[model samples]
Target: MRKEHEEFVDSFEGQLPPSIIAEIKDTCPASVTKEQLKEIVELTLGLYKHCRVNAGECVGLVSAESIGEPGTQMTLNTFHFAGVSEMNVTTGLPRIIEIFDAQKEIKTPMMEIYMKPSHNDLEKVKKFAIKIKEVVFGDFGAEYVLNIFEQSMTIKLNKALLSERGLSSKDLAAAVKVKSKGFNMEVGNDFLTFVHKGKPEEIRQLYDLREKMRPVKIDGLKGITQVLPVKRGDEYIILTLGTNLEAIFEYPEVDISRTMSNDIHEVYNVLGIEAARQAVINEVFKVIESQGLNIDIRHIMLVSDIMCITGAVKGITRYGVVSEKASVLARASFETPIKHLISAALESETDRLTSVVENVMINQPVPLGTGLPGLITKLK
Candidate 1:
């Protein structure tokens, strides 16, 4: 029975895609006769041929319209991530703009860090989550006392904050001492005293020192602003507010295979351009899905392909994918027409009028679809 299916798949090798062929073979049951399987394959091939786009189709224009039409319905509201009120992510139209523009610095950079099976215990994952949170001095919930007379700054650390971060008073003192110069650190039960060893006339430095202490990162990975251990399915995963892909990948317990950052540029830098391309598609689809729209995936794939065709991710903006067009008129038609025209004129460039926009500007049929072919007649 398996041999019969294999023979059928082999006979339709070039007609059907490898993936479709494999699916048909794998999904067909032994109870189904050879004739039924052949009929199913024939129907699938017919649908595939019918759905395929014709040559010279203006796919770029179609894709733009497909995405833009649905984009009008998207909201401008931000959404709470995974029911975590503390973390709000930009969504709807704004997020779509951010993705398509290929913005380097996003509003809310985040990471979904999956854990290895060996370290996937609830308590262990919780500990791992806290271990990566960026513990700045401000997070300590410390009360500051500034004394100009003695040129001393004292910080009364909250015991709860200390225990949660797994830092002792001595560790805090040592961290402060290492961060600041010419300061004598005295560690007590729940407080640390910093006495400046510099000139007494520099008493104003105490105020500066007090303010500087607020942002001091005493422990944990840098750029990880907040961490939440959330259970997805049967495994516990860590979701972070800020992204630090390089540092996060260094951890042993992290399932590096499945871990990914929401920052597309970070993914490009860390995992290369291919991953960035996939990230673009995924991010765009996520926004569209969240808005309750059901656009075809092929349109999204086409957009991503254009963005990553140059071996680097470029946005759909004038300065990005638009600027790379071969036709001067096509570039001019997009934005800043006078600027593009003047630049081309100054550079002594020629407009071949190869694409749709350029030919349309000249009152000629677009070089696409039925207009793609030229008719030549020999006069008698």
Candidate 2:
């Protein structure tokens, strides 16, 4: 670890998390060249200075205008997997709304899973991706056979397909028994059977059992409906359609430091508020960049800070952080002016007219910058 760099970050009085501190130290280790360390230090200091906001800067107005301007240019097109119309991901404007609104469930919740250094090999990553992909019992069954006389069901496995997916008859049998119980299972070379000795009218149970067993997840991470391993630069990274943050973090082969989910709330819940704040900034910038829009990252950061100021994720919407503004007129300006005015009047809420909007509403000069300095004369 680099002692000077560690001390410099620690000077923030634990404002920075240990993982970030460790990452800095690890990257600029004591063994690294002194010139490199100097460059890193200068970059870190420069970033810190760049992030600091001036006192009386109307950050809210700046952020709103910054993001809102480019947001109007976003397309409403959805990204769908060919041949599977139902597996479309919400992108562009809708995706931005899903993030900033702090919606509990997103249309397409996903994760970019980074593997540990040891598991970065192409074959290893490819196998790992398959292992993490959600596998339902229906994948193994070539044909579902239900005998009316025996009141039993059998899943005839396609030997080639089953073997290709790295599944065996025993695995299929175990999964069927675990998911759909009460029937005695018999595993054979290329088939699995479920026999239930029951009354003739209870044959309806056979159809129900088949339906229940078909969708049962026999293996892989639950909620991760699909996984695509793509090689980026030198290493392989897994892109999953559905997110399972809690479960993915538990795997030892996963590089916890780099593994991040697209769902802001999931990131907030799994990681702390700071991580969530960073996610917001990254996600917003990502969308902007995708549309080839050039906006100052600082504006996005300001918005993120406001959303996470209460130490939890809140949206900029009327029901979220915006509604809790200290100034009543600001809230009113956001949404439902009449409702806000009535509520404020009934509650006897005082508006100090300190902020820009409130002062402008009452035809007073806004107290920002030069306006903040009121002239005073001493009695002669």
Write down the lDDT of every candidate, Cα atoms only: 0.87, 0.82
lDDT of 1 by residue, 1-380 (tens): 47867897779988888998888878878788878887988899999999889877889889989999999999999988766778999899999899888888999999999999999999999999988988887667468888877888788889997888777988877666756677777889998788887566586777777767778888898989999999899999998999999999999999998899988889989999999999999998999998899888989999988888898878889999999999899998889999999999999998877788888888998878888765233346
Worst 10 residues of 1 by lDDT: 371-380
lDDT of 2: 0.82
Residue pairs in candidate 1 whose N, alpha carbon or C atoms collide under 3 angstroms: none
TM-score of each: 0.87, 0.72
lDDT of 1 at 52: 87
lDDT of 2 by residue, 1-380 (tens): 55665666566545545665566777664676657765775677667567666656667777778888888999988777665556677778998888788888888888999999999998999889988888888877898888988878888888986776777898787766766667778889998888884444588887888888878887889989988887788889998889999899999999999999988988989998999999999998887787788889988888888889999999989989988788999899988999999999999999877678888888988877566655222345
Using lDDT, give the best candidate's number: 1
- Candidate 1: RMSD to truth: 3.4
Off by over 4 Å in 2: 1-55, 80-89, 149-151, 158-197, 202-205, 327-329, 336-380
Number of the top-ranking candidate, with TM-score as the measure: 1
